[model samples]
Target chain A: MPIKNNNNEIGDSELVDSARHGDTVAFGELIGRHSDKIYNRAFSIMRNREDALDISQEAWIKAWQRLSQFNGRSSFLTWINRITINLCLDCLRRNKRFNAESMDQIDEESGGVERQLPIETPNPTRRLERHELRERIDEALQQISHEHRTVLILHEFEGLEYKEIAEAMECSIGTVMSRLFYARRKMAVLLSGLRQEGY
Target chain B: MIDERKELKIQAYLDGELTIFGRYKVNRLLAHNAEARRLHAELNSIQELLHHNELDHPLPEDKESFRTRITHQLRVEGEGTSRVPNRIRPVLKWVAASAATALIIFAGVYSLMSPENSNQTPAHVLLGGESIEPEAANASFITFKSESAKLSVVWVDTKSSPVASPIN
Candidate 1:
């Protein structure tokens, strides 16, 4: 429980103070604490490990430069997560890898299978272990359209609420929900198949 | 009443967006409906898996390398303000010299035109121009006096009435 507390609670104010006074070590500590989460979010969007890593690092640099402006209205992780998400979104936009048309098309085309896929078949015993389940989820996440993957990651991975996801994604809550629904349905299908596949 | 109530509150409860009453309704429904229980369990498992997955993935290489690169970049930027390309330095120096020269010329012209120095004659006027008054002929005189030392002074007035009479 204490470990959980330590992991969840960052000494953000201390880091901010040190960083404000130009302590790179303190900034690095902050980076080390949040880097994994930031990298994962970036990876969630960019889908390329190198791109994710690059963007996440760039996001940290930007966050350090802008640390003075943080008002602590939200949690520090939330603030950093927002920056990472924005950087990833910019990278995605610049690469022209994701577009509304592609997302809409994915939803329209994939929605039927997405819905028909039984997310939870009554299981007397869960067939796939958690690790295998995770791999399936990762693969399924990759297969979904970028826009939907982003919403799902923000919601499920980052634990952001619908409103926060909408704000970060620069879309409406309705869009976030729709994307989440589609993404979850697709995930359930994919995950069920992984169970069937015995991987 | 229970079915209607559960239907009303399922999403909010599952999303952790519900108030106490809504949660109570969801709890009550979960007590009876196997489907709701299964769905909630699935959702919770999915959320947990996603959060755990974030921890599971290794830190990307770009992150480590980029941090090093960025820190080095910032240090270099801080220490080396003169890192401007060699090609541009000469051009900048030339521009700076030209600007200084232009400023000097401007200041010189401004000072010359200022009213504070209005009485100063233009250099061109002193070349060869004659005095405006007409010259008088035979208007030169010499005076000598012996006092402590013999002093002789020569005076000339061309425009005076030719010294109407000789000096006494």
Candidate 2:
């Protein structure tokens, strides 16, 4: 649906067909339509600007190379998102040794592993302006580790099911659920912290 | 840690990733216990936040530069299918050799650094070195005779790697 840009009169399906035939212009059109979303997804997963840039470009190159293999089973954006997500996952894996041991380390100040921070207000996010809420969410996300954050992005933002997440993460469905659960609880703590900060 | 089974039930109920019976059980539990209700409300608010308030981070402002870089790369790749010009053939081999040499030197330097810093090649190191896309290497017929050397450069695609999560 995002493919119908004013500058590009063609639909995504048409562009994909042309790009499959090696039309650079068609592929460029496709890139123009979806690169930002792909870049955003990369940033969400990688949590670094430069890595997001490299990974996003790499995803495009891969999409261009693998264009013909695309069967139109999913939307073009979905296809690109999958490519970007996989690349992010790959980048994360390649560099996993450099990161923290695990995202499972509970915050010392959070009191315990089963931190259920009381939601003081009825709906804190409702009180926030759109941009302010995003800032708060981004801040909260930065506090979580890659594993937890990745699950949150894949489930909530990308709308992938637990099984799909398990497949992408190469883990069991229960692991996916566990990570999702941990991520949500962590988010609750972070959001409540923001509420306390008067954000 | 909380009761693992009870926590799972609460998350399942909130996610609606459960069967009818599991749903009924959590519903009854939440109705009866004030603590469970509070926990449910806290968890459910996160869902609302993610669903209604999640915002995408902005891309770099100079997006056109990125597009230009990708466009140039695509054009270069398009030209790759054509025959390598005779003049550049020898240069490419020398470059590969130089790359191998440089890789060894860089690896030695990286290997000696503080364990924390040497865990992975960071941003500056990669920036300073020449990069060949793995696809570009795939198109070439070079082979490393040394098993250790080959193993060092082997690409590990994380998609297929075995992932062990804490829950598992």
Candidate 3:
């Protein structure tokens, strides 16, 4: 049976079942519950607010249409997030952003400039507050190439393995490792620079 | 200087993505090489920073507005995709075409038999019977009878439009 409309107390599983039965209200509730996380994930990938908003809405619509196929193998948010990530990847491929990463590819093949930088012993980010650190990290993410940042997000944030990321990004596992290593080294360089500035 | 491949191998070991032999190789490199050890430490710290510190952003738009947009799109797409079945589509097209053709033929016959046309013949004679006075046919027999039976019996008011009168 469909849950009463606008009821916030219902669990996600119940709402999902009701939504699968064609209850738009239940689906709306689910959207209301998870839109922020969905939007944030999209923003992390796309790095543009308008694109993120568009992708997030598109993801929700797709999730609604494919609700019956969602067999509860993962949580509703996880399932929906997978949809959002796939859409972001599609948008990336459609825009041919990977072609823009050719220079980064050359860098990866040769270990990049960050390879020669000195490795700092102490934690460079130790002085900054958590909020400042997050802001700096986001700033740093925006500076790197898309492929490298994506590898980092997949491995670190989404907890995907190298093979899984390779499949998602449609690259080889070796490429995944290479990009991930480059991304971390680049991040280390950026954070070390921030620390030396006494922030 | 460590080559890029060995550097990545060290990272893989740090991530626990390495097999047992790969791990053993990285362990030996880290134990012997101070540079590899420092690189490993730096990479480990960065991974920890990212793993625990993914930024949480609130939805830029209000919840109600975002939900409304998504629900509106769903409704529009639902209507757009709710199409007629493929098999029934051709049949419906044929039926519509037949109806249109029939209407066109009916209009053409009606216009040809209209009273406004001076060339129009008497209804009985047009049906291949003897030419009868319009009033005489209406007063006695409403049916148009033909010797060769070229046309069936159909009542027509010569004064009014042809199809307005019913068949006898």
Candidate 4:
């Protein structure tokens, strides 16, 4: 007797294929697997719970509508991430509060020379309690511009490569590098102060 | 002393973006320069902190609301109903109005330009010696032309109306 793999335990590509054939259950499973990360990315960019939820849902809706066009050039998660990021960018564009100029001015005002103090002193953040680090990082992330913060989240949190970050951001690799550099610098300066404050 | 080229190379090296040859050059610089080594440490620390900071932040409970809203929207749209009721209703109203206006104009022109209405004649008529009266209320003299195979009943009024009736 030959052993058989259960259809319910299908891989992402197979699930995608079934979803393309109009199987809503397969698509629902895909959503269940990725919704958390997608929601987190949206929250990271939008900084609002409601907006993040809306964007993630919209991304999934768009994925379903355009599923036939997905040619598997990238992983399904990546394809969906691109959709979510684009939706977030659209939301940001509409808000006018999240524009690049306003963000840059805010950073300049808050990020003076005093903000550049070093935070880590031979104690790795990994060694810190996980919950405290999460709180600190989340708070620190809110201080950076959306553009810088997005690159950081995609690169550091999501573990996307520079090229993938560039694709998600619709920018050149050099731009991704430059943005990542400035973002890391700003984060270091912010987190360093928080550490010294003993938070 | 940190040269400008070396500083840029150090940043690239920390980012893991340097070519192998470029990394070798920066490594050579690091071997002799204390400042280069410090810069490397600072860069490395930043990367580590950024990577580890947000690893465990669970999304808020309300985050799922967006997904629900979007799914509802997609369902509604996929049903093929109007997304913008106000916008589309006005457009449909305009199209209907324009069609009605065209129909009225066509009916009016057709009534006026039809040959039977102008000639005041039945479509088929036969001829004989018998006298046939005109349908309209007026005195008239009947005239028939055999060469053209035409008949005309001229009303008594100088402002006469043309009529054609069969004589049997």
**Worst 10-residue stretch by lDDT in candidate 3 chain B?**
B143-152
Clashes of each: 0, 0, 0, 6
lDDT of 4 by residue, B23-103 (tens): 998999899998778666766777776665674434566444534555456556656744333225457756756654554
Candidate 2, A92-129: lDDT as tens digits: 88887224535334442223464544433334533667
Q: After superposing candidate 4 on the true structure, give the runs of residues whose Cα lies further than 4 Å from its correct spot.
A: A1-8, A97-121, A161-167, A170-175, A193-199, B1-8, B52-75, B81-168
DockQ of each: 0.12, 0.19, 0.31, 0.15
Instruction: Write candidate 4's Cα lDDT for A1-199 as tens digits.
Output: 1113364567789878866655555666677667888887788888888899778777888898788779899999988987888898778768775565555544443443323443243344335566777787788888877878887888787787788888866778866766666676677766775555553
Better of 1 and 2 by DockQ: 2
- After TM-score superposition, what is the CA distance of residue A62 in candidate 2 from its true location, in Å? 0.4
Isolated chain A TM-score, each model: 0.80, 0.86, 0.92, 0.77
TM-score, per-candidate, Cα-based? 0.60, 0.69, 0.73, 0.63
In candidate 1 the C-alpha lDDT for residue B48 amounts to 50
Off by over 4 Å in 1: A1-12, A73-75, A100-113, A122-130, A194-199, B1-12, B18-51, B62-66, B79-168
For model 3, residues B88-108, the per-residue Cα lDDT tens digits are 545766776665455445644
Task: Give the CA lDDT, 0 to 100, for residue B72 in model 4.
Answer: 56
Q: Top model by lDDT, which number?
A: 3
Candidate 4 — which pairs collide? A53-B66, A54-B66, A57-B67, A119-A192, B128-B167, B130-B168
Candidate 3, B106: how far from true, in Å? Answer: 36
